[model samples]
Target: MFDQKDLDSIRESRQEWESETLEPFLEKGERKERFATVSNHEVDRLYTPEDVSNIDYDEDLGYPGEPPYTRGPYPTMYRGRTWTMRQFAGFGTAEETNERFHYLINEGQTGLSTAFDMPSLMGIDSDHPMSEGEVGKEGVAVDTLRDMEILFDGIDISKISTSFTINPSAAVIYAMYIALADQQGVPREEVRGTLQNDMLKEFIAQKEWVIPPEPSLDVVTDTVEFAVEETPKFHPISVSGYHIREAGSTAVQEAAFTLADGFAYVEDCLDRGLEIDEFAPLLSFFFNSHNSIFEEVAKFRAARRIYSRVMEEWYGAEADESKRLKFHTQTAGQSLTAQQPLNNIVRVTIQALAAVMGGSQSLHTNSYDEALALPSEEAVRVALRTQQIIADESGAADIVDPMGGSFTIEKLTNEMEAEIMAYIEEIKEMGDGSVRDGVLNGIPQGYFHREIQDASYEYQKRVDSGEEVVVGVNEYTIDEEADPDILKIDPETRNRQLERLKAVKDERDDAAVEEMLEELSEAIDNGENVMPYIIDAVKAYVTMGEIMEVFEDHHGAYQETASLA
Candidate 1:
C-alpha cells in the first residue's frame, strides 16, 4: 500500500532513530531487547513490502464476502451484525446448568454453548459406578433425554444457536438434541446448532474415541448425510483444531492439521455419494485464539483463502457460500495462567480481538479463573462483557478485515498458507489419500507426537536460558500471596443427579425401553440411519449407558495399541 518513496523515508527515519537514540539508550542495559512475537521463518528484523512482493490484492484478498474470502465472510462484516457471543456454560446438574444458561441469556449472551461433564461426554449415566466422583465436576451431568429436556426447559432452540462440545458419542448427543427440539414443538428443519462430530480429531488429539476408527467415521458421515436431508440449518461436524493446539502443536501445525482433517471429511462425504456443494456449505470449523495476536490473525486469513481454493478448485464447489469457510473461535485454555489470575482477563481480551480481526462468526471467551475451576458467575459475566465492549465501544466492527492490507499481515498470511500446503503435501505423500486415512493408520499421531516433543524442548530451552519471560512466573516472583475463592460443585448435587436418573429409570416402561433399544440395534446392524431410532430410545427414557451399550455391542469399542515414536 505504501509508495517506494514513502517506504524509503520510513526506513531512513528508523535507521536514524535506532543509531542515534535507541543504541545509546540500550547500551546502558535499561530496556528489554526482545519483541513480543517471533516469526515462523528465521528473520532478524521487521518485515517490509519486499517480504510480500508476490501479493496480488485481487487474487490473494478479494473484497469482503467474495470468493477467495481472505478478508471476511460477510459483505458489511460486523458492521451489519456482530459476531455471536457464545459462552460455554454448564455445571452441576441439568437444573443448575439451566439456571446458569438463563442467567447468561438474560445478561446479553447471543448464543449458548453447552459443556457436558466427563461421564456425559463418555456416554455413561450418572448412576454408573464410573461416574461417581465425576457427576458434575467438569460440566453438567446429562444421563438421559429427561436431563436434556430439563437442560433446555425454558429455552427456545429455534431462536438461538447452540453448540455442543462433545465427541466420541456426538451422534447420541445430537439425537438427544433432536428429540428435545421435537418436544419443544420445533421442526427438524428449524433447528440451528452444531455437533462436534469430528471423530478424527478425537483420536488424533483428544484421545476420546468410543468405537473403532472406521465405524466412528461411518457414524460421522451418517450424521452429515442425515443433517443435509433433515436438518439443513444445523452443522453436522465442527472440525476442531483447538484441542490439537492445546495438545502442543504450533500455529502452523494447528492450521494444517485442522484443514487436513476437514479435507478427509469432505472426501468421505463424497464417497458416500453426497455432492460437495450440498454439504460443504454446512461444514464449519473451530479454532483456538492463542497469545500470538498477529500470527493468529494471519492464520485465520490464510485458512479461509486456502480452504476456498481447495473447495472451488479441487472439490468443484460452485456456490460462493459452499466455498466460503465459516468458523468459530474459543480463547486458548492453555494460555491462561493460575498465577496472577486477574491478568488472564487481558490475555483473553487480546485473543478475542485477534479472533474478531480474523472474522470469526462466533466466539467463546475464556474466563479469568478458568484455569483454576469451572468459572464463577462473576468470571463468566466479565468474559461475555469483553466481547460486548469490543463490539459496542471499540469500533473494530466498523471495518471488515481492517488489517488485511498491512505489509506484515499480508506477508505472514502468505507464509502460513505455504506452510499449511507443505504439510498437506507431506500427508498425501505418506500414501494416505487424506489426513484422516493417515490418522486412522496412526501416521498423523506420530507426526503430532514428534512436533510436540520438539516444541516442548525448545520452550524449555528458552525458559532455562532466561530468554523467555513470563510475567508472574520466572521474571517477577512475588512473596505476597493472593488466592481468590473459586466455585466448586457441591457433593449433594451429584447425589441428587444420581437419584433423578434412578427415578426416571424406575418410572419408565421397561418393556418399551427394551423394544426401542432392540430397534436401534437392528438399525445399526442393517446399516440404516440410526438417528430416528435413537430419538425413540431417548423418548423412552433409556439411559445414556444403555444406548452406548447397544452401539458397543454392535460396533465394538476402539482399542488403540499403537505406540508413538
Candidate 2:
C-alpha cells in the first residue's frame, strides 16, 4: 500500500505530531488512563494506512461472493435482500407459542426461531417427575408430534424458514420437523432451515448435554451426513458462538472456539467418509453481536475470511458455496442491563447495525425487556422493528461492507484472523493434528474452560473496579424504577401439556410405536445413522423422552465436573 519512503515519512510525521500536539493535549486532561473495547482489549488512539499495509486487497479481501470473503459472503449483500429478521420467541404451551409466532409474523417478521423449554431441551416428557414445576417455564414444551402440530398449525413449512434453537435433543426435534414436513407433503429437498445441533459447544460453554461428548458428536455428524443426502437445502448444524460469548468470553475467544468446534465437526464428517463439498455448504454459523460496533464488524469479517481460506486450502473444497461462510447473528443478550432496561433498546440497535454492516444472513434482535423476563408481545414488536428500521430507514444497508476500507477495521480484522488461527492451531496440536480429538481432549481437560474463565474473571474485575464502565451497572447510579410488564407462564400450562401428551399416547397405535422405538434402539446400537429411525419413531408419535431414554440407557448420562482452576 505504501513505498518505503512514504512509510518512513508517515512514521516521522506521526512522531512529530504526537510530541507537539498530542502530548500537550494529554497533559491537560484525559477521560481514562486506558481506552478499551467491551472485551477489554486495549484500543489505539488512531489508525493509518501503515496499520493495514500488509493487507493485500485481492488475496486477503476480494469482492463479495469471492474467496477469502472478508468483504461479504454474497456479491449483492443487502442490495440483493436485507437479512431475514428472525426473532427468537417461545413460552408456555405449543399453542401459546404458536399464537406468538402468528403475532410476530403479522408484525413483519421474516423468519421463525424457536426457543424450547428446559424440559423439552433436556428431552424429558412434560408429565415426567423431573419436569414438575418446570414445564414451559423458559420456552415452549413439546412432548410429541401433537405438540409440534399445534406449534405450526397455520404456518406453511414449505414457504417459511424456521430455526430450531435446541441441542442435546436436537436430533429428536429435527426428526419431528422432518416428519411434519413429510406429513405436509413438502419435499425433503425443498425443506430449508437450521438446527442448533452443536453439542461440542454445549459441553464447552452452555452445559447442556444428554450423553457423553464422543457419542453426542457422532449424533451431530449423523445429522450432517443425513442432511446432505436428504434435505439438501436444510443446514443440519449451526456452529454456535452465541452461548460461548454469553458465558463471558472475549470476542476473539468466541470466534476461535466456535470455529474450532465447527472444524471439529467437519473433520468428524469427513472421517465418516462423507465428501467435504456435500456437507460444507449446508453448515452454518451463529455468532453474538455485542456493543463494540467496530470490533464486532471486524470479527465478522475475519470469521468469513478465515473460514473461506481453511475450506479451500485445508479441506480442498470445490464448490463456491462450500467455501462461503454464511452465518446468523443475534444481538448480545448478556449485554443488557436490568437496572435501566430501556437502555437496551439503544444497545440492541447498535449491535443490530453492526450485524447488518457485518453482513449477517439472518438476525435476531434482543427485546429491551429481555433483561427482566421473557419479552412481552409489545417488547417483541419493538425488537422486530429495530431490524425493520435498520433495513428500510437507516442507510447502513445501502452499501456492502460499509466499513470495508477503514484502516482501523482492516487492522483489527487482520489481527483477529491471526489470533483465532493461532488458537485453532494450538487446539489441533492437542489432538495430534485432529481438531475433533483436540476439542474432545480439551473439553475434559478444561483448556477451554480455563481460557474463558480467565477472560470472564478479568472483565468482571474491570467492571467491579470501575475500569470498564457499564451504564446503569457501575458508572450510573439509579435509585428506583417501576417494573415493566413481564410475560408470565400460565400455571395451568403444565397440566395442559401433560394432557396433550397423554392423548397422543392414547390415540397412537401402541404396537407401532413400540416397533419404531425398537428399530431406533437397534439402529443406535448398531452404530448406523439414527436419523431415519428417529424420524420413523416420531412419525409413530413416540415421545421425545422415550427416544432419549434409549440413548441414556446405551451411553449413560454425563456428569460434568467443574474446572474453575
Best by TM-score: 2
Q: Candidate 1: which pairs clash?
A: none
lDDT of 2 at 354: 94
Off by over 4 Å in 1: 1-44, 443-445, 480-482, 562-565
Model 1 weakest lDDT span, ten residues long = 36-45
TM-score of each: 0.93, 0.98
Steric clashes per prediction: 0, 0
lDDT of each: 0.85, 0.92
lDDT of 2 by residue, 7-39 (tens): 889999989999999999988878887888998
Q: Identify the runs in model 2 with alpha carbons over 4 angstroms from their true place.
A: none
lDDT of 1 by residue, 500-549 (tens): 98899899999999999999989988988888888788889888889888
Best by lDDT: 2
Q: Would you list the clashing residue pairs of candidate 2? A: none
